[model samples]
Target: MTSMNHNQRRGRVVIGVDTHKHIHVAVALDDFGGVLGKEKFTADTAGYGQLIDWSMTHGHLLTFAIEGTGSYGAGLTAAVRRRDIGVVEVMRTDRRDRRLRGKSDFLDAENAARAVLAGHADAVPKTADGLVEMIRTIKVAKDVAVKARTSAMISLKAVLVNAPAPLREQLQPLSKMALIHRCAGLRPGSMTTVEAATKHTLRSIARRWEQLNDEITAHEKMLAELTTTLAPQLCAAFGVGADTAAEMLIVAGDNPERVRSEPAWARLCGVAPIPASSGMTTRHRLNRGGHRQANAALYRTVIVRMQHHEPTKSYVARRTAEGKTKAEIIRCLKRLLAREIWSLMRPLRINPQTVESAA
Candidate 1:
């Protein structure tokens, strides 16, 4: 009687969530992988609270294993962490499992719980509630603006290539900046002729390019200020520009301590070497996983250093003299750069517990 009651009271529970735009499906599982219950919640403040209260009814809320913590699950993750419960990011169910059993939101939610119970889902989702998140948002805007500006420039050039003979010959002689300025100043009053229509199109594209360029500049300025404030040592490193620094910071997230070590940081950037050796031929290959954007940033930094930074230039020369291919040398440089950036940023890691308690 009393013993049975105490055993019931000691039950441990895990909750898994499959989140969507408007709703989230959740499943509660006991420690031994028994299905406790399932529930659906609205993807809002009220719904998140209800889900938490419901899970507590099953037993002690050990953890929430959630998919899409960086996307749809972001809100619930923040809310859960605010209550000091652990959140483990679980990847979507394996395709083979789905093929075997078919699929539903409930199944996914169940798989998430199972992943946590089986010791497979161990990743701590990014906090996404601090300075790094601000940098990430600004970086996204800057990337879009730069991409739009480039597209506008391409369209303007394509128009030039197909413009009337006289117009093409006239603009072909001008430098890119001069051509854009001249086109932006053109006035195609009524657009009654092909040439006039072409003029209007060129003016429209040029103006769009100008506007996007200005927007990009503003975004870059903000990124520079924000990234510098977040990691001064990273920004001060040679060949580490505002854009590259922001990408690195975005990869590290608001909680750098979650990264574990310098090598883990390298692995996260996709610059780490993966073993691909045989018994008699030991070797490694480029890692194709992790954050490619951060990898690209690493490449960009290495390129700049190769050309301008004296020590890096010397290293390149020495490696080349030792018969390393450019690709191999570049990979080596990226790994080293990842290590350097990781150390510079490590000291800046925020203690999320302190932050949550303070809040």
Candidate 2:
């Protein structure tokens, strides 16, 4: 009897893709994890179509394991999903595994398929085609502008410290904002002396700071408007402002359903308690692995509530009386806040206006 080919025996296929800026390498494996075909395609519309068609010929397209779904693979993921094909985000192969198996584009592509077949790569890639993406873009711009402004201020201060006596004496006592304003208004006309040159440099830096401040303000305003429109209830939640709300929204992505459950969300925020049990030392420890920005947002919310919300203040007092350290109390509070935020975020994925209408 003739031996059946692997594709014929398995019938179903999985495609693994290693994406890059200009090209994507793909490998197709049968249900039994046998490589059927491997190909390289350009990272564009035509290439995506060819890749899909190429994989389909091996057998039925089961799912796609793609690296960098949020970065280089984003467009391809969207394209595949639009055609109703399943896609999962695959992180880079472990260094140890790479070292053992040896490395090549085909090897990485095959690894991605093996990961999917073995259930190692099961994360649903984010559908970054929504208002949250817009918020992320604006936030990134604002963050860069703020950093530049801060650097400019630091350099301006450094110059001021070494400035000529006449200029230093004039500006040394001014507060930060006042100093920027004063330097921006300096009328240093000629580079006749060291003091004049110093004044000119300070003025330029101050003007740049002013421009960045305006840019940040504009971005904040856009964030406020978008957050209010997307999830008014989240924005209105006690102690949650536009910046904090926006950060959390970005973490949850446009389709929060992929987050799975509240516990998962808590883990994503790094507020979940991790089991640290050993032989007879059963306990939990604070998790330190999730999105740090989301953790900071939760921390800020807890602080605001502790200061102004009566029930939270009473809870704090009770915890303190129960011998909990301040840090421990904050950790507990962060976990609780993460659960509450998760509850609020779930409805957002389905209908962002649900909370607003209820209110």
Of the candidates shown, which would achieve the greatest TM-score relative to the real structure?
1
Which pairs of residues collide in candidate 2?
A: none
Candidate 1: tens digits of C-alpha lDDT, residues 171-201: 9899888988999999988868999999999
Residues 111-203 of candidate 2 have per-residue lDDT tens digits of: 998998998888888788788888889999988999999999999999999999988998999999999999999988888988888989999
User: Can you tell me which runs of candidate 1 are displaced by over 4 Å?
Assistant: 1-8, 350-359
Cα lDDT over the full model 1: 0.89
TM-score, each model?
0.94, 0.93
* Runs of candidate 2 exceeding 4 Å displacement: 1-10, 352-359
